[model samples]
Target chain A: MPTINVTLYGDIAQYGSGKQLATLDLDLPQDANIGLLLERIRLPSEERGYLFVNSVLHDVPGLNASHNDPLKDGDHVGIFSISHMWPYQYRQGIHLSDTLKAALEEKGVMKNTYRE
Target chain B: MARKILRIKMDDLSYKYEEVPSKWAKWGGRGLTSNIVAEEVDPTCHPLGPNNKLVIAPGWVSGTPAAPSSGRTSFGGKSPLTGGIKESNSGGTSSQKIAKLGLAAIILEGMPKDSKWYVLVITKDGVKFEEANDLLGKGMYEVDEILWKKYPNKPAIIGIGMVGEKKLSNAGISVNDPENKPGRYAGRGGLGAVMGARGVKAIVVDDTGGPGVEIANMDLFKTGRKKLTDAITSHDLTKPGGGLNSYGTNVLMNIINEAGGLPTRNFSAGYFEGASKISGEMIAETVEKRGGGMTGHGCHTGCIIKCSNIYPDEDGNDLVSPVEYETAMSLGSNCGIDDLDYIAKMTYQCDDLGLDTIEAGNTIAVYMDSGALEFGDKEGALSLFDEIRQMTPLGRILGQGVKATAEAFGVFRVPTIKGQSMPAYEPRAIKGIGVTYATTPMGADHTAGYTIAPEIAGVGGKVDPLSDEGKSELSLTFQAATAFIDSTGYCLFIAFPILDIPEGWAGMAESVAGVTGQSITGDDVISIGKEILKVERDFNTRAGFTAADDRPPEFMRYEKLPPHNEVWTVSDKALDEVFAWVNS
Candidate 1:
């Protein structure tokens, strides 16, 4: 099992188990993606929000399948409810520039390209 | 169908209609106002004296249904506050009303010799000046209520509060919102004081029988309108359930706070422990639990973003409609007051007293720094309102603005640029916005160039908030784009969708082209925006402003904001480069 640091912002703080930026050591198996992380955090299903994995925004995948990108150890994740307007709309789900995307991927992080 | 300009010569209380000059034919809103002020008014004249002129013009698409967000009006004059050229824009039904009446701009010139108050009644028949001595010294809400009831036709009322009558440097002109609430304000610079100097209390515009906006190409207008409506409704930020629609701009509280840039307690700290108390989420929840309050209220018709809200008290009575992010932060955590209701009351007081909330917030914070009162003193903060209402000597000084308040007590940490008070964002933590605050001709106005979109909100493109790398270009581009947007009568919120969605930009250009028959391309927007800034900068230059006036306060460069523990480090060479292209 590996641990990760997660932070909640905007309205998601209400559902963050009464914590905004706490190191929640999650006991999850290897290759666990954002879907499993969501399930562990117990974010209500009705609520819509955006995810930022290692400072790169990620699109919410479809219900039938999970965008289970392999999560590495020490990856930082930020969860913000949809109530929080996603300001970086240019990179809504992914950075368009190949140069930026390549740089993001080089840092052991997934680009916001993978979606259902 | 020629649009007329209503020119009111205040020195003689005579008015006449003039043809819109061919040179100014393509201009509207900020573009029109800036040109009129620069061409006519003496830049070196006292802003509230006989030589200054006030020009009020609507955007090109204001009355037209071409853009859902197109209803903004611009008020421009030499600013008594910043002592430079100023253009303040606001959203309300009044702009559309004025546009429908086929008037391009209402120019108020000269000053009255006597204190006899007057009201300008503008109907489809003609303009009539009536005595309004009975209405002076009344709150804006009261004036609106009385005039709106007397008119019975729900005419759009544009007036000022007692602060303007008192000629306070920070006084703002108020316009009625969609609900007839005098809540919308062209609320910067001291334009209201300019209007007060003309002895005009209010302008009631009724477009009941007037011809609507003339469009050159109706089919193209429809096409462009459809494209823009689709873009605004589809974009994640402008559509329903989007950030602005769901939580208003106040949603920025946590994001900016998370980015470690939200100014607290007079910019002393970057982070406030009590920020969440006044967060958009908390306001929405409080409004939900209390009832009578609405989360998504539009300031004007066709405003789909609905970023405004109605805050209610614990008993479900309306306290204030539209507590904006700037007002929330400036009066809330920025003043060390965490109580949302208390902040709402202060917002109401500012509106009622005709003071710019951003300026009032900084002035109050300076009072705290001067040991007049302690931070988070709810009673003390509330007492400041009473003092202002009564217009005591101290109240009069505070009403003058942040610079006056700072000088009164000899406080050095005055967070201002070009005499105008800074808004909610702390410059040290958000370096890109700091560059904007330093370089914008409008003097510390965030809306002049909202680099926050990219720096913190990540709207157009992501820029590191703490870095100075590409900020000058970003601020320059945003300022140019914003000037054009402000000219089009479209709400600034439209930028969120149009910034990333190319179709949205094309649609805006198409809308202007269709309405004006001018074939405006995207490149044309850039040139037009740039031209407007140059016009403003030229006026300011003639008014004696220089490169030294373009930088933020000395404290911003010296004092380090917490959380990031950074000071403003943007070079002056880059600051001067912001307007270099104007000369080129």
Candidate 2:
């Protein structure tokens, strides 16, 4: 088993420590991925707005590409509620995970919002 | 009822109306102001001298009901702070009123021979100047209250405070919001000092019974308006209860901190531990608990995206209308202060004193780095406002802005480009914005080109924020696009939806076409934006700006910011390429 540091923000924090912002450490199986971590915390994938793995963007609401990427030990993950936004202008040239980068390239143009 | 220009000769205390010249008929807002300043004012004249002129204009669709968030007003002049051409715009009722009154622009020129301060009252009939002896030395809040009582019609008032009267380099022009709060501001580039130099304290615009804006093509306007309204209402980041409407612009505090680009502690660190305390989420939560405070507040009428908020004190009294993200970062995290209440008070004081919040906060931070005041000294920070009011020598030095304060105190780690302080973002961590700060003629303005959309949010396209590759092109593209948006009278927040939604961008062009009765396309809009940049850059060149002027401070290249621990690595060749197209 490995432990991962997770931080949740906005409305989604209720799924973790029941506060607006909460940081918790969770123990998971050896081959655990982001999907497993989400399931363990009972946070649905649909409710997440932005996801960052060690400050590298991995998921946006409309585009989720890192769900199956294996999580390493001591990894830090940040989850944001859909109500939270990071405009592109402010983050231009920010680092992106390979998974999200590939997905964005395949999709060609970036879309604004993602809804069920 | 045709649109006309109102020229006020402050030296003679007289005014005249002139028909819109054929060449300038198509220009509005920043486009018109920059063009007027470039054509009429001498480039080498002292920014606050008699030879300098202040030009004010609204966007083409400013007064029309069909254009949402299209009531922004632009003020243009040679900047005393940057010593370059500058256009600073703000959202308020004045733009719509000026447009409705059938005025294309207002030009204030010449220095008054008399020492008496005057207030200009503009109505449908003409302009009248009255001595403002009683309003002298008063903060903008008291001045707004007095003027509202004097004018029963509740006209839009644009005024300055003691800082402007003293002609401080950081002084900004204050515009009254819908609530009659003098918080809305064209608060950049020290334009208020120019207005002050002309011996004018305020300008009141009353549009009662005035001929409204003439729409050349009503059907096209309506079509474009509907498309844009649909895009705005549907966007998750802008609609009601969306990110902006729910928490306001201060929402960036947490995310930027998480991304290791928050510019904490005078740009020495990138992450601020106290970011969440003064974030948009905390602000909204406090506003909900406090009865008198409100979220989703509008700065002006006809704005669909109400990202503004009214923060309340502990006793349920209104403290400040909005505590913007830039202010929170510059005054809060960057200065090592985490108390939200204190930041709000500082914001209100800055607004009332007619000082540019970004410049004022950065100056204080530089002063702190100079060992005058310890970081996060709330009481000492608050007392500086009184020092400024009392006209202390030390206060005057701080009021001159970051570069001056740094030079005065012998602080070598100054964060400025072209004599203006950098905004909230750390250039060492975000290389693209560094490119923008170095290359923009406006001198380190975030709004000059916001590449954060693609770099952080993945809106238009994704880019690696840490990489220096392609940043020059990214900055060039954004700077041109932003220049166009600044001229539309529409709020820059619209960039979010328009960039993501193709129809929204088209609607913007169509709306302008409908107003001016000239067909336009997306390419034409970008071309106009580039043209505006060219005119501004040319003026700066004539004012003695060189390639050396277009760069970040040397400290940024040597000193690495924390968390990411990155220094500015963008090549100088790439920076010069940003404006190389202008000469081409």
Candidate 3:
């Protein structure tokens, strides 16, 4: 049972206290994806924002995997809500979750687009 | 409304109105100031001497409903602090007033031979030189109150405090906000010292019955302005209840601390344990409880974002309007103090004294490093404000800025570049902004190119904040974008939405085109930004700045910031390549 210590920020803190790291001890499978972790935290699947695995902004510069992407065991994931992504529409052409993309359009937040 | 240049010759106290030169016709704000200083003022001239000219200009969009946050004014001169070309821009009512007065640029050249201080008042009628001797040695608050009472018609005042009058390098020019508080400061690079050298206490502009900004294409202006407004209101970071709007810019306290790069205790550590106490959430909650305080306060008119906030005391009396993120972090976390009340008090002192809060915090932190007091001695820090007022030898040294203080005490670990102190962001943990801090001609000033937006906050796109890869290009791109944005007189906060939204970016360029009828494309704005950078860099080059000058402090490269434990690893070769794309 590999546990991921997840920290939530801004509006995402509503899902957890954020005072302490939410110990996610779901004991999920090896190389479990970020969606599974987000589901465990009870954060909505449609929530659009940034997820940093460790100190890096996820999926930006083709450096790391994004929210919909896979997470390695013992990874520390930090979530920033969609409001944080406003200025950069998911830096460096990231492929967001379908639910997030749909929600962005539905909320009239943006076109769920990325600048090349 | 035709634009004119108002030149005040301090040598004989004569003023002249000249036609805006053809080359300077398209430029305004930072663009005009840098161009004039680079072309006319000698770079090697003494920054506080007669040869140095203090150029003040409003952004092109000022006095026009072009963008939500476009009332920024630019103060440019040879920096007495950085010893390089400097442009310090701030948002206040003054820029709009200056623009409405039909002046493209108000330039003060030549130093006075006598020591008498005067106030230069501009109106639709003419310029009046009144004896400001009575107001001499007074703080900006009293000075502003005196000037406002005398004018009574709500004229915009650009004045300096007692620190500036003493010609200290850390002194900053204070501008009156809409509430008549002399809080909005064009604070950096000792331009206030240059203004002090001119022996002018204040420049009061009464824009009543004056011609406003001339828009060439009303239809295009409307269309472009709507696009920008829509983007600003629609974006989550800038919209109502968004991060900046709800919590103010200090909102970054928690996020940046979590990212492990908040620059605590003079850049020794990347995280502050008490960051949450001084975080934006705490500030907002306090504001809610305090009756006198208010959030979503705009510093200038036409600002839709309203990132500024009014901080009140326990009794709900106004302490400071807009206790900014930089001031809070520099005074709070960097000094190891967690209390917001103490931070607000320090901020109020800095404002009243007309000192740059960032420099004051940095100097105090360096003083702590010398073992004069403990790291979190709030009282010790507060007491230094009194010393500054009294002008003790130690206070005078600290008033000169962080570089001078460190040099005076022979203290190492002085976190400054180009004689200017670092802002809130610690460079060791955040490498991209570190690159920007080192490379930008404006010294360690973060607003020069806020790569923190994309690198940390995901504005343009998240580049790894801790990594050096793809940073030179990112920094260069941001520097070019920011230079142009600063010229337009838009608040740097707008970069968040504009970076992510193409419509927002396009609309900004279009708005400029509509106002000036210049047919400016998005690409042309980039060129304009690059041109501005070239002018600044050329001036710095002639001013004796070199590649060696373009670097973070020696300790930053060697010392590893804790929690992150990351040393600044950006190579010189990469940093040297930052300006390569400026021409192309």
Candidate 4:
């Protein structure tokens, strides 16, 4: 088993420690991915707005492409509620996970909200 | 009805109405102001001297009912802070009021011969000047209250505080919001000092029963307005209960912090441990917990994407109207102060003092870095405002802004570009915005060209925030687009949806065309933006600014920021390439 630090923000905190910001550490199997971690925390994928794996953006609300990203020991995951948003200009040139980069490239253009 | 230009000569208390010059017939906002300054003002003239003139103008669609969030007013003058051509705009009732009064622009010319300050009252009849002895040396909050009570109709009030009256380089002009709170400010480049030096304390615009703004094509205007409205209302970030409406602009704190570009502790580092405490999530939570506060408050009437908020004290009393992300970062994390209440109080103090919050916060952080006070010294930080109010010699240096304060304290790691302090974003961590900060005519401003959208949010196209590739073109595109958007009197937030939705962008241009009765396309918008930039750059060139001025602070090139440990890697040639179109 491996432990991962998780911080939940906004309305999604109810799924964790029930505070505006909840930071907790969870033990997971080595084979666990982001999807399994979300399942363990009881946070539905549809309810999450932004997902950050160790300060690098991995998933936006509608663009859920990082579920298969493998979790390592001591990985930090930050999740926000649907009300949270990261506007393009403010976050321009920000670091992104490889998973997110490929997903965004497939989508071609970045929008405030995404639909399948 | 043709809109009239109101010219007030302060030298002898004279006024005249001039017809719109045919060359400038379709110009408004920054486009009009920059052109007027370039044409009429001597480039080498002192910003606070008699040779400098202050020009105020609303956008083409301002005061029209069909356009949402089109009530922005621009204040232009040579900035005492940056010694460059500057146009700082704010959202309030003044833009709509001035437009409804059938005025295209108001030019304040020549310093007054008399020592006494005067207030200008603009109405349907004409302009009247009254002595402002009673209102002298007052804070903007007090001045707004006095003017509101004295005036018959609920007129829009524009005034300055003691900082402006003293002609400090960091002072900003204050405009009263719809709630009569003097929190809305044209808060960059020290334009307030220009207003103060001209011996004008305030301008009251009474548009009651005045001739309203004339719309040339009602059908086109309606069509464009509907498309824009739909785009704004449907966007997840701007629509009702969306990110902005729920958290206000402070929402950027966490995301920027997460991205390691928050500029914590005077730009010494990229991350702040206490960022979450003062973030948008915390602000929204506090607003809900504290009963009297509200989210989604509009700065002006008819704003569909309401991102402003009213922060309340523990007792449910109003603390501040908006504690935005830039202010929170500057006054909070940048200074190492995590307390939201203190940040709100500092925000209120900046509003009342008519000081640019970003500059003031950076100055204090620089002072803290200089060993004057410890980081997160709440009481010490609060006491510095008293020094400014009392006009102590030390206070004067702090009020002059970050560069001045750093020089005064012999600190070498100053985070400024072109003599103006950098806003919230740390340039080393985010290279694209670094290009924008270096190249914009307005010194170190984020809103000048917000590349963070494509780099971070993937709004237009995805770009790696850490990569330096194609950053020059990214900044150039955003800068030109921003210049055009600023001219339309629309809030810059519209860029989010418009960038993603083609119809929204088309609607923006169409709405302006409908008002001016001119055919406008996307190409026309880009050209107009480029034209404005040319006028401003030409003025700066004449004022003795060189390509050297369009580079990042020397410290940025050498200092490595943390979390990423990256230095400003954009090439000098790349920086110059941003405005390569100027010479062409």
> Top model by TM-score, which number?
4
Query: What digit string (tens of lDDT, one per residue) describes model 2 on residues B124-218?
Result: 88888999978989999999999998886899999998899999889999999998999888989999999999999999999998899988999
DockQ of each: 0.16, 0.44, 0.15, 0.51
User: Model 2 chain B: which ten-residue window has the lowest total lDDT?
Assistant: B451-460
lDDT of each candidate versus the true structure: 0.78, 0.85, 0.79, 0.86
Per-residue CA lDDT of model 4 for B297-321, tens digit only, reads: 9999999999999999999899888
Clashing pairs in 3: A87-B459, A88-B459, A91-B461, B309-B322
DockQ of 1: 0.16
Put down candidate 4 lDDT per residue, A69-92, tens digits, no spaces. Answer: 999999888888877766655666
Q: Over the stretch B130-228, how does candidate 3's per-residue lDDT look in tens digits? A: 878999878888888988898968889999888889999999998999989988999999888999999988999999988888999988877878888
Ranking by DockQ: 4, 2, 1, 3
Query: Model 1: number of clashes?
Result: 4
Estimate the lDDT of model 1. Answer: 0.78
Predictions: Cα RMSD each: 5.0, 2.5, 5.1, 2.2
User: Candidate 4 regions off by >4 Å?
Assistant: A17-19, B450-467
Q: Candidate 3 chain B — worst ten consecutive residues by lDDT sum?
A: B451-460
Clash list (residue pairs), candidate 1 = A87-B457, A87-B458, A87-B459, A88-B458
Kindly report the TM-score of the first chain in candidate 4. 0.93
Regions more than 4 Å wrong, model 1: A1-39, A42-78, A86-116, B450-467
lDDT per residue (tens digit) for residues B438-480 in model 1: 8777889878873223322222344332233556676777788
DockQ of 3: 0.15
